[model samples]
Target: MSSKNSFYSIAHQVNKPENISKVLPYYSGLEIDIAYSASKKQWVVAHHDFNNTKHYSLEDWLTSFKQLYSKRKSKLSILWLDIKTLDDNNIKDMLSTINKHIPKNISIIYDLGRPLNIINKNFSYKNIINNLREIDGIGCWITKEDLNLVSKVKNQLITDKVKNTIISYGEVVDIDLEVLYKLCEINKNLQSPFSKVFVWNIQYIEEIDELIAWQEISGMIIGYKKQMWNDRCLDQLKYLNDLKVKFNRNTPTTF
Candidate 1:
């Protein structure tokens, strides 16, 4: 890996084809919500449950990404697939479809809810991860609701032997530096699972600074809005080049 830390600044929910050209040039990647359409028998780029609501095909979205990627050939683009409706029967098809459309510059990080959801009969989390590995996809570890479940989460990661996970940064208010510190400690001891951490729901550039300065985060997924990319914010983002530093293993990585 390169000595310079690889930090991804992603645009969240840029699911439409029209937005791809606008957003790809400014960010490292795009986070797209996908749900399987039973009626259409194909994956659709949508955040809500299946309905008549306007949504583009997953193929269309990936096509748009590929076109933009061809222009920005050097950029490493990640497609964070937040699967809204994943089930056992449709997983193989979903993976196959993604493999066909995903471009060379694109990397995939998929989220399928809790890996150990006992009530979810859709599919085993580990099984989906294994399938994703076949397509060179990275699995994600979403932070849970109860703060006390840290130990349990650690055990799960150990059992799965999952390295290089994308972590979901829930509501900023719900998390503080303390929780992020503990997560870093877990990653430190575990050695590799959390080596590459991507946190979503980041609204401000200062939050980006705080996360990067602390050293645990490798990526930031900012919710997409035109005004969010104001002059000050863009300047701060550009200043991140100066902020980039090598990963510090000797010290505890903060949030």
Candidate 2:
């Protein structure tokens, strides 16, 4: 079966490890950025801008997250380990360090900012596809035109590779009813559940209602203002759960 058929598999990306224990139960997965310091020769988890403040060193990240990371083999969620500004050797070395010290099922997805327009156009995807064989996930920025092109590329890719052997995916679509409808249409055509949607900063509980009005996606993202975690991200999870239930309702009563 295709992998694009689920709904609002909401994900969260942040540097604060304190939030991980608090938020993981409510999320599908986590998106963490790893910054490799040329001078220090270290890979650390740092998400925000300026000086790349260390939330957790690579060891700290794996040590603290061993429980969560180890389980990816049995239950995969989007564990996006974004390595910033590294040459080929450094990237591999960092992953090696992670495996040695932090030993988890990692999928080093190159978060392509432009994917089609720039970040990954010709050889970028192939580079990762060829070099980063251990990577199990992918995320690309979305535009309608790009969406069409990527869907075609994804279709061609899976045709050659072994299914379920890897977790390659993309869901870079505009967040609108029309766009979601198109995504649904694509989901219907491809017959797969979505693996990730990288949009962030969700405020207004009502917007959650809007995005999942007719969809129940699993494995995606939701950036939240401070407001989202006021009650331990409970309100947001409630909203997502409602959507999940809506989708479940359809599973047994499809026309």
Candidate 3:
């Protein structure tokens, strides 16, 4: 809705929690592997394996950012609540907390591996697509982690998943041209299902952006390695924006 974008939602991988402001001007949003807590009730944005940053918790990171989120308006755009290693028991509590912490429409991306149960979720993948039942939506992530998952969807009863899930793909993964084409085709046909094409977290920012842009990915999930920021990511996004404008008239929105 805002024509605005979030650039490098990062993890507290290697940087300090406070330096986010220093580099905030460089990109749109923060996407981290983990979340940190600045205080008992507040959260800070961080993402590192587990050992590197002891204090890194999503809650603390956000708590820190809340103080300056408005001031660093243009630099950061989105926040990533990646649960690469989470359990079923935590889903409800985590989702509830995130729903409260994250600003509306800021884009919170969860791992495909995570078992999802939205508002009316029967929590069954099968029940999700009962047609008569359609509960909520699902996550479509494409990364080194999700690429295979996306590829497998065609083989799987993915249409069923798509029917009930808000699909998004591409996040910090390596992608291929052929894969992109097939994905685009799937996405094109899936528009009726309103299945979204998520392409924003690929590490090879420019490698396949052209491929990404040619397709009408439902919504993009911008990524960042706070360590590298947009030195590479920004260049790719800029190219994507330029190409979009150039072909604004003649470009086909589907594969």
Best by lDDT: 1
Compared with the true structure, the alpha-carbon lDDT of candidate 2 equals 0.48
Query: Estimated TM-score per prediction?
Result: 0.75, 0.65, 0.57
Query: How far out, in Å, is residue 30 in model 1?
Result: 1.6
**Tens digit of lDDT per residue, candidate 3, span 99-185?**
555554344444344223222243433332342213233453443344334434533445444443334444245445455556566
In candidate 2, position 92 carries an lDDT of 58
* lDDT of candidates 1 onward, in order: 0.58, 0.48, 0.43
**RMSD (Å) of each candidate, 1 decimal:** 5.2, 6.1, 7.5
Candidate maximizing TM-score = 1
Q: Compose the digit string of candidate 2's lDDT tens values, residues 1-255.
A: 223344433444555556556555555555666676644566676654424443467767666666654543323333566545434345655656655654334344456444342233343344444444443544555545555654554454465351222122233222454554565466546644334443443543345544554443333455554322234455666766677677452211100
User: How accurate locally is residue 24 in candidate 3, as Cα lDDT from 0 to 100?
Assistant: 57
Question: lDDT for model 1, on a 0 to 1 scale?
Answer: 0.58
Question: Which candidate, 1 or 3, has the higher TM-score?
Answer: 1
Ranking by lDDT: 1, 2, 3
lDDT, residue 104, model 3 = 47
At residue 244, give the lDDT of candidate 2: 63
